[model samples]
Target chain A: METAISGAILAIVTTQKDKVASGVPVFFAKDQEEVQRTCILLSRVLKAMTHDLENGVYILVRH
Target chain B: MDKTIQIIILGIIVGTAARIYMLRTDYRQYPSYPHGIVVHVSLGVLAAALASLAIPALMEKEYTAITFLSLAAQQFREIRNMERETLSKLEELSLVPRGLDYIEGIAKVFEARNYLVMFTSLVTTSVALWLGLLAGIIAGITTILISMYLMRGRFVRDIATVKPGKLHFENSLLMVDDIVIMNVGLEDQREKILKDGIGVVVHPKNDNGRAILNNLGQRQAILHDVSILVGNKLEVGEPDLTPLMRKDVDTGKLALFVVPNEKDLECVIEAIYRTPILESAAYYPLKSTIGKSAAD
Candidate 1:
């Protein structure tokens, strides 16, 4: 499987296969731009909330 | 009254007094309230009495009386377990929980204090029995002062320089003195943090200080102490408002970001300095031969 997650990058998505398999809901992005764009988009679609972990991860959790 | 009996009585009184002086409910509110104080003092008196009797009993060639000291040791171990369990349970209710490392350190201190009381009494009684009343009183006072001094532990300010840092946002990232704390996507939250947040940068003086600061448990303890003193500005569900401590990997400096109810930076810094260095998290690299050579 070509995993979308790459070394310490932050991202936002509807769901991730690796996260599902591991039973931990997290997403990764290649850079800050991708993280911000994906998070803004996902917040609208999922009607959830987006939070930055400040390290390099963005969390989209149900409010 | 016999000299042995007088010496034993004096020893117990001095030892119990020393133990009572050491018992306090400071920032870490263990041995809580009237009931807790009563329990500990009672135990302390019992330990002092047992230890004081040992010297006189041995002087009279009563060898079996030494077994009571071993029994007292067993009782003190149980006290340690009680403290650890109670603190662990109370931790669940804490807003900023003291980590397990801190809890263990506190429990160990409590247990060791009882043994210190016993030892103080034993020494006092021995001195009086061998020499005289005046010598015993002098020895007792000196021992109590020494025990009090030994109980005083090092604080964060002993090894680090804490200075107030300016909080600023650089392209959606919150920075405290060039150290990135977190990224804020919400404009409203960012505004709040900017208005109310206080930042402190702790620069470690030596390799030992750096190692201690690197422990996550120690960092969490600092955050907890600071929050408890100044009051945390976070609500139950607001994870975004959580205080953070981030370390610069290169220079070993740690930056703290907190939104306190009181925006007094000086008070926050004072509280940080007063935070007790947890025993388990203490790292003394300077004590080693290799580290000594490196420093030189």
Candidate 2:
């Protein structure tokens, strides 16, 4: 059975970090499916709130 | 009687001490917290020099043996404490996921600046010899002060101090200080998700209570997340994703990552570009955004 997508919360870098630096994390996830689903939801919410968020690189491969 | 020999010896003592101070600051390990060393050490050295100048008779009692050794021991204790504090800071840096790049770049810059700071002290020795002990100490102290100021301003330490805020969450509605909506998305699209590819299709709904009737002659408008009802599944060998390999310390193959299509990704983005209309109640009012920024 496919992993049921679930919503979760995660914080991301609100500003630019150095080339090798990762932004300070303010969010967490319960599981992989939850995190993925939350990420998808977040993409929409951010686009609705701010359009710059939509300009991110999305990587997906056909199964 | 000329004091040329005494002046030479005094200059050597002062110059060597100053040089050593500059070197200590130059190579001082980072994340030096509880940091009272810079001001304290400079003050101590200057005080010692001033005392020697005020009463040159004290220098004749062979005070170098016990005094210098004790001073060295105290300085050693401070350095050890500093090293331990630095080790703790380094440990904290490792725990944080991001900012590794920023930290590394900052460390390199500090190393460079340290060299420049130490180089300035060499020039001070010549001035101290030609001028006097007081003049030499003043010039050395000035240089150290300037370098310290610059380092504090430019050095990369930690993220701009974070303050704790009251966070609240609800079902479907999350509020993070003043009603803010969260958003997320990926950059992949596909007809069928073998791994994690997105599927986009047009879902045209039929009007009220019409199960048999089709909506707008098959499909009138395209919408995101409408692929569940569309797209045919693979009949034969279970649809699989392309495999990927990565280098590891030991021999091991990496898990495959699915690539999303550009079209589907854009479609979802377009859908999100449409600001979220406040979904209240059916009988109540639905707050529709008349093409305005989401913040408003």
Candidate 3:
């Protein structure tokens, strides 16, 4: 499911709560701070491969 | 053996050569290596052959041959669509993508170039058939030169001034000159931008230049070209480091912030100047009657 949070400032894509499936590959953040925070949390805690897009950031998770 | 056949042969050779000379892989790099070159060259040969044959067929009162020319025109329109599709797909892969307006401008140019080749061949063939071989040679050279002149559209330097500017921060925000680029919340990334980044202010010469610079596509084109030329410092996870262009709301001056691999300020300025004016974004406000009266 795709959810736009913070008045379209951040977009999150996830198949289930606390479990990001492989198919959901993109995430959007409002600015640098949000992107960095999201990427760090996803990478370190969730063990996902995150990349930055110009406007937002995306993550790749296996199942 | 016939004079008509010999003249047509000469036209095809000259016209094909002109087309080949003009097909260069430069900054934009639309028609890439091997397959792309082959496709364009083959189409060029077909166009030249059809155009050269048109004169003799008409001279002999074979009016049906004119229909073939119309068919070729229709084919070239498909070429434009092909180019647009190819570039749009490739744009997805680019680190800094060429915007839709730039892509459309490039596609249109490819279509127009093919038509030019056809016209050059027709003119050369007509001259040879009516005048002589010497006249045909002269006409061929003249047409090539004329095509070359027509192909060179305006560049950014023709209408704007690019000069280096200092990058500073106002609290947490990154500012290039007086224009604010973005808010940098992290101290580390802010330092990185300050250490490696370069800034330039583009001052439009007139209303036309202002209008062109204001186009989002044109500004993006400039950022892309500059990044390609000097090389971008952005990594996959660093959204903060993406090159950005912002216009001063009051003055209409565009400020560009780039973190390039090569730090030479002059080279960055030169690259910005050499960036081609996107045909789709080109505005000629000064040429219009209303604009002229307003200026007066």
Question: What DockQ does each candidate score versus the true complex, computed on alpha carbons?
Answer: 0.13, 0.05, 0.08
Per-residue lDDT of B1-296 in model 2, one digit per residue for the tens?
23434443453354335434543432223333334445434534433443233223233455553354345445445544544444446645331111223233333433333333333333344345557656756765666566555644311011011111212223322222333222213212121332333322211121110110122111111111112112222221222211111111121111112223332445332432231111110111113343223313
lDDT of 3 at B245: 96
Model 2 Cα shift for residue B233 (angstroms)? 45
Ranking 1 against 3 by TM-score, winner: 3
- How far does residue B33 in candidate 3 sit from its true spot (Å)? 1.2
**Candidate 2 backbone clash number:** 27
lDDT of 1 at B140: 80
The predicted structure with the larger DockQ, 2 or 3, is 3
Model 1 clashing residue pairs (backbone): A10-A29
Which predicted model would earn the best lDDT? Answer: 1
Off by more than 4 A, model 3: A1-7, A11-63, B292-296
Candidate 1 RMSD to the real structure: 6.5
* Descending-DockQ candidate ranking: 1, 3, 2
Using DockQ as the measure, the top candidate is: 1
- The C-alpha TM-scores of every prediction are 0.82, 0.27, 0.84
In terms of lDDT, model 1 sits at 0.81
